[model samples]
Target: MLFDKKGLDNQTLLNLYSNMLKPRLIEEKMLILLRQGKVSKWFSGIGQEAISVGVTMALKNDEYILPMHRNLGVFTTRDIPLNRLFGQWQGKASGFTKGRDRSFHFGTQDYHIVGMISHLGPQLGVADGIALANILNNKNEVTAVFTGEGGTSEGDFHEALNVASVWQLPVIFCIENNGYGLSTPTSEQYHCKDLADRGKGYGMEAFVLDGNDIIEVYTKVKKLAESIRKRPRPILIEFKTFRMRGHEEASGTKYVPEKLMAEWELKDPLISFKNYLLKEKVLTPEKDQALTIKIKEEIDVALEQANAEQPIIPDRSVELSDVYKTFEYQHIESNSKAEEIRFIDAISQGLKQSMQQHKNLVIMGQDIAEYGGVFKITEGFVKEFGKERVRNTPICESAIVEAAMGLSIAGIKSVVEMQFADFVSSGFNPIVNYLAKSHYRWNQNADVVVRMPCGGGVAAGPFHSQTNEAWFTKTPGLKVVYPAFPYDAKGLLATAINDPNPVLYFEHKALYRSIRQEVPIDYFTIPFGKASLIKEGKDVTIITYGSGVHWALETLANNEDIKADLIDLRTLQPLDTESIYNSVKKTGRAIIVQEDSLFGGIASDISALIMEDCFEFLDAPVKRVASMETPIPFINQLEQQYLAKGRFEEELKNLIAY
Candidate 1:
């Protein structure tokens, strides 16, 4: 078949050819380097170059594209410096991630490209978030996200597609059916005849196209992008293609049949496109040879420049620098009159104030818009701040968290609320793998806060009542804020919202209406790593957080002769170890209390810290009071036995008597 070249000019056709050719040539060179032990790995995009080039060239420069590992053409089409890209592959300091990551694992804001994490499907939700931002800003920009057919089976894929369709977001899902996902064939991946057919189930428009035909891909995608921009709705396009090479250089194609490889080889995108250009007299044979030589020379120069750059060295200071954005601790003093408010109301007021202060802030959760959430914390928020800001998301935790991450990438801060703290398990991947590692991986600040209604005392059983603060505190690049009192809850939440990093804000479900304090009406922020001293004494030091703080205060009140200094650790990640040590040293005895199970909770870590640092100053062995290592029971009597409250007072007395 000869080329039509109807809507495209000769120059435009030739430019598309050039874009397709660049990545194919670069990939060949990279494979050579991989075999020669110069490059670590290569995910070849030899036959699928058309999809990358076609999709990238179809979109505008400002429209964001979330691409996979094989989309090298996305970088070249955006005119990303070849030297810096090569530097990235070689793990040099001049790389986009400054040698923190390799290959296409890092995103560059300059190119409007959101890099794919290894878990391919989460980026789909990210695309929805970007499109949502575009809609909120009243812009017609669309977001295009790419994934392989194997990725379509992931939960995130279904969740993102459903959410995008429900919200009427302007997004184009480009699923490259590249025949295989790593070693698994499409036959083993899904039951659908075509990946695009899944779009119909999600209530979106669908298309199937020949990915090997560059002209067909380019023309169709350009038209689809324009249509989506005007209509502002999601569209799914499955590009039926094949990966001519192994998943990577190390994984050979022994699993693929020779006949299948031969069939795909004849339909090679670069070769077929070049033949069409020659047949139409759009490109001469002599000109094609010159263009190939030019691209090879360009790759050689880029390799030379990248080779001259110094590789990253392992320095402690340099390695620890970009884990999280540097935050300054400031204690704001307010002279406003105090009003008594419950813990839940304090958090509500703080969130309301933050929304008023930061216009770009968005809050999303289940039943949050009209129903005002399950707890009534966000009651009347939709009426005040519109549906765009106070969104009610589907019961898809993974998609909403990844969407919040996307919002952060688009310079918008987002707050994600888990209906209960135990439900965080569904959204743990994006929080720990993507959101927590975004800054360290690519200097992308994930300005998002995940609010968790945690803890036990209301007999809500295992699923609803569990103190899971340790889940995020152990994960680096995340801040964990757990407060007990109304004043601290309001102050710490405001600080978490303002921090330019991912934060896990744990609110005790039992303390929502149980605890009240005279809190200032105005907004204020408490320092993250500072501990609050409830009372001072010289006999013993009690360390606690969340619900344990109240138990400690009650014990001190009942036994005035115990003479204890009570310390409340407001934030668990930037734990106020200074205050803890000072209090422990002065009192000469320490007791760490927590509501979580006793085996591997935060109390164990605190007890160890006190043992190591306050060893000489201790007058008695450090004691830890925590719940029994059992699942939270449904019965009130069994639940009370499972909690630390049952034994905390006795434990404190035993420690004092020692």
Candidate 2:
């Protein structure tokens, strides 16, 4: 053999060859299924089998793996049962995602593998979170993550590498340089001679591997994996290979050059390994034929079983059941002697209490360490809980969120603070795609809370001030909580921390210091989907939340004769529709006030809700008073005019008169 195999026995080498052959044969059958119109799509990693098998051979069962769509051999090598795998591909109930997804979009915790989403590069950062969790748990288990050469161009690639290096995390980033990304060649994707060369810039050890040689790939990755567990530093391996097939069955190989395709076909990893095994006399021709027959029979049975199994019947109840953990109302007792505190202090106390209550809770954000935060919401937290728990990440929003998803998957509750709510646009993909859809798609619990300090009126222009809760409210799997008063902010944040799904907690920046109220000293949680009736009246109902609640209250105080009922919607998603309908039914008129822009905002939806549910009871058209559709201005006068507050009195009067 060209590569060292001093410790590997003959049986081990035979098993490695078997593992490499399995995925190649399985995917080949899958391609046939695709052609036969039984399967939707097929993405084959035919030539890259050696790297996937070799890497899997080095991995311990307890170690974590975040695999890309192309690494089927990794699953085979890890002893993932063929029946269940085929079940996943066929969208059966026995599949990992229970027909929610197909083709590598699912994973099971039992296997310690995270099945990747369609979007690439984000999983690499998530792997670092797994590594970080392992370190915290003192398991010293290495996490191996895969991506393509094309994925290196993604910003998440660099962010993941930087965090892994800075924290000395035990993660192996394997890049399969398969020569093409869908149709775009590597030449167009990058100028770097080797993708591993980029890893050096991140202050990590990197090396190249001949991806077709199973012996070399296994030996090198095994050594690297062992060293990583001991020292806990990131390592990058660039596996040079070729894509024997097109990106997927739908994409023909027309774009691939005939010469290049022929050359790679000649160097097919399976064929090369078969020749090596024959040359080494590991098996006679008759025995090889017997092994091949056995594998073919196994594949035939798996295929037959998968075809016979009933597909998961699509049900709306399954889709809605896992969005949030259903819990009976606990009815937390109120503290009559509670101390008065500002909104920011209430938030800090909530975080402190949550961290104290749950040892697994981790808080992360920029400038949240010794600097507390830009808003000081996390001030003195590092000192109280230690830096490991209260981490200050780099200015990478996507990685911050992606890491939270990883940590959550690793059985840790993560609370991420977005320095400015407007900055959430940068990390919107993970929040909307991964965290928000995890439970609904695969029943994966993403216990993450993203603290967004939102809204305007402090003269902070567009970039720093934004009410982005509306954007997330439209998403299905996420819970949106926007608190107006200190009592709700503290209680709802605690609830968000305890919830098993992703919650976007929007704290109004304008109310951080403006409002002060007595909050329960003990750790308490407010029930989700419940609105608070701040003031009771019979004439008109003002439905508002966050800073808009304060504005509505002020407007009502000035116009006491209006006899308005002010309802603060503490949670945007899982909105208290019953409370809204009840209030509007009594008052016969309703006004929805919001700090978000008027166009397609939450206020518009609430207004529509009232019109639909309470139309018969209403005396006038459902009114929506929100900020102008235009961006907030830099000038103080124009900024005030741009806000919902500027039109509050006028809109309130119009609604009352109507």
Candidate 3:
């Protein structure tokens, strides 16, 4: 009777068999639809359904799961409606993402299951973030993230695993070692035999198991899930399985060996489970057949229902609606200001005020707890908010970014601090792909702020000093804020914390201590996409932000004859185009300044916008003043020469003369 069924009850065995059968049948129908040109593409997990179904069934419904594309069985086993599943594939209006995406790239707050994007490794870090949040809230829950053997080779895999291990977060990493990454054999993917060995290196309990054996997978995963809930710890389990089909129907199995295909066919999870059910007398032939017929009828009806609905129209208007989760906040009177404070103190006060105002707000960064960060931005925050809310994280930048995404998914507003802006290169995947695009993809608010200490006036050198805001300014679905004044810094951070989209808040290192101004201690809100007009004149317009704004002011003071209109574009993405256009229209001359490099800079974009919107009002060609296209030199004099002050002053004088 198939080795006594591993002490699983007959009902449990029947449930497992049924769960394995549903996804296999659904994917089979999808393959038929693909051939008929009714569907685009399908990633088939036909043979390896047991692993997804087993692990999913083991966890409690409340525990979060981040499932990859192949884990269709996870959705089916969780009783996700077949109509919605088919609707997504058919690109119907009722689909989870409303036809914005076709594959595993949607999520629902109600379901607590994060749908995945094309990039695989970031989800693991996101799951770790969710688990860490659960721990902070003292919620007894474990998070499970799924990936393939190939994903283990990614840097994020190691980054997430190390953070989870060090923090002892409640997480289970399930690696399905199906022996091929799109056509490359597992032998070529890694030198080691088992992916679980990497888990051991990360200080986690690791194991390898028979993935086709549903009973063992369910029992072991259930035990581990229950244990981790009580005392949080991460574990890794590698399932040794094989994909019976090609990567997809289009990418045929030409690279697969005939002998290997034949071998895996003999161990087909669905057929083996059905045979076991029949041999053990778990169900009669008629009953088993009836169950199959029932599931098939259900799938067929779901397809019909999904097909009956209208296909989602590609509407640009609909795309614009959910770009940012804009909210209305209380506006204080004009004279509601409190006291004068430095830029660094304003940041500390803003964070403290945000945390006090919103209980769901938390701060996470490296050495931010007792050590108070390298710049002491978060100093004394630990004593006030406790260590649970203000957390000290490892040097895993990608994990930090992704975990904040997870926290936002769990209905928490997280503020992530990069010790230096240059280090953002390490976490660029999640920053650009996951955090920036989540809202536009699925109508979900990423609801996170990444605080970057940027600029190179202090000669922090190439590694620590960088002005990378230009990169994010060009990206859609992200709000890039670089505040110049202490008042703007405090007010904008408060607003960014409350924003329902991902905002990259760039705090210039040069202005952190050099600039101090009168700022309100009380919470205040600054509307996004609105630039502040620092000075108004008719001769020329100088548009800049962050540290560049100060340089623009200096140029104005030095050359009063120029009579320039100064505009500080506090938000770059939701750019204050109206202010820029109006100023350029009035002055009939414009100069864009930036701390980033000369070529391909934010000033270039601003210059283009001015040309398009105010061409009739122009007096001369739009000019741009930016740093030279090279890394910031260590010497202060060279760095000054590379900056935009002297060049911007010359441009302004020339514009006035013209």
Candidate 4:
């Protein structure tokens, strides 16, 4: 598989040389681009060009890559349109991300690239997921994730490796041995002498390659990547290379002594490869120039095309788009099921029925498989649904969500259970990035339902008892729902799962076993973007959601004189403004109630909406009932102070008296 001048035909060898040169020249030209306004920034990847280009070329065409910012060479070598590449740096619409993403988010899916740019090490988990998809699809496509030594220090790097090893997924984790991470050198990023030394801990076959040598980098990677894919296992490849530019355009290696920068520059990957090609008679200056000029011309032309193409303008109209796919709203027969169902069982029955209707549905989380999750919601389901449908994943939040997103993109309806709502942060990235924007970014839909036990009531300490739904209400492309009782939980869940968009179906942990009501054995569901009137009165509109609906409604029953209109926001993303406005118009007063802290909570959003839309109708200024602006306390006495205890009553009396 080695592309040696003596070993390969002239045509093949010449192509390799050309591929190696483009990245080098692009990096060289980028200096001028920075001076002009064309490319506002650059990650030179100068000395590492040969390794990125050569190794990438060695792999099959359809293989997937999650490369770091420094691996600019790899994209060019992989043949992403050059003009689009330049336009990306130019911050134009035709940029790979349609200009919605940052300059670094340039990988195109058509080129077998699943793009990412969170922190440095997060791509490892994603790479593993992409590779897992390929394995399941029985596609011989390998996934390669590249990062710097700084990224290797990240915990996700190890988590991804371990998961890949355990699942035996086909991913090549490549560590480009860039001597430093921004200002700090390799000394600060990790203690490992060589990164390969750390791979065995994850049960991966590790190998180190001389990244400065193009032939060596290519041959070794090709060997490992092919072997890993054929058998479909994971491997760790350490490419000993260097970062030739600042981390991004903003960073300057002022700390690195000029002597050190100059010393590293001597091992420039492109120059060294060129010398090898000439010495071996693989290429001459004339042929190299012809290739370079041809590529440059093609790139210039691509620039015209990409510039001519329009940027995908980000919009708010589609703000409610993709939260669910099935447009045909199904009726929720909640009234018929008023006999024997508990909140938790309703959730289970809803999932069971919906999954039965849809064959692509899958559910996974810690203890979700055999234990039916900690709440017993998924109980007896393991026997009925096979392992593929009900899976028990390791306790890694990133992995759990990442894997679910992977399954979802492959056309499976993935439902990820976050053991508790507090733990939902584990899978936040996949929820926000992959699922939320997949439809918008790639025009590909990822139908996913992320179900978590939310809210606090049972004395499960601060971590175990938390209503974190407010934490993610503002997240675009995500529909946040909190079902108070069994009826809505099942119906709303059905609506959430069937919808094209990704949903965060928050169920109260307390409601699981607390209250029981009768539910009939019929298929039914409730629509999103619509609100439910749990109780109706003429004094004040107490807008609440999730478990808060129960508390607010209960508070209303205490004093018959306080006729509060309870608007239950079954779906949070759409905000059900019409419901809120109608109630405010009729009652002439609005008071938002939620259990999350007052600041940055759903209450804030509702209050803002009320002031903007129903301001003219207000009897008084809007009022809100929420937790104190502090973390939930560990002590019960302290916790009471932090909880949303009696604001509903106080607000009710004040508004009536007003």
Which is the leading candidate under TM-score? 1
Q: How do the residues 269-339 of candidate 1 rate in per-residue lDDT, one tens digit apiece? A: 88888998898899999999999999999999999999998768888886687899887766676689989
Query: 1-658 in candidate 2: lDDT tens per residue?
Result: 2545557788988988888888888888888888898888788888999998999889898888889889999788888888899888888877887787889988778888888888897888889888889888888789999999999999989999999898889999999999999999999999989999998899999999999889889888999899887888899999999998889877878999999999988788888778778887875688778888888899999888889998677788876786765545565655656999999999999999999989999999999999999988788888889999999999888988998998988899999999999999989988998898887667787889999988898888989888888789999889999998898998888888888889999988888998999887888888999999989999899999988888888887888788888999999988999999999999999998988888889988898888887899999988888998898877789889999898989988887787
> Where is model 2 more than 4 Å wrong at Cα?
1-7, 325-331, 334-336
Q: Give the TM-score of candidate 2.
A: 0.98
- The residue ranges of model 4 lying beyond 4 angstroms of the native Cα positions read 1-11, 304-339, 409-411, 427-446, 520-522, 633-642
Question: CA lDDT of 471 in candidate 1?
Answer: 84
Per-residue accuracy of model 4 over 506-546 as CA lDDT, tens digit each: 88877788778766667688878889898888888989887
Backbone N/Cα/C clashes per model: 0, 0, 0, 15
When summed lDDT is taken over every stretch of 10 residues in candidate 4, the lowest stretch is: 1-10
Report lDDT (Cα) of residue 364, candidate 1: 98
Report each candidate's C-alpha RMSD, comma-separated, in the order given.
Answer: 1.1, 1.4, 1.5, 3.2
Highest-scoring model, lDDT = 1
What TM-score would every model get versus the actual structure? 0.99, 0.98, 0.97, 0.91
Query: Over 4 Å off in model 1, which ranges?
Result: 1-3, 329-331
lDDT of each: 0.92, 0.88, 0.87, 0.75
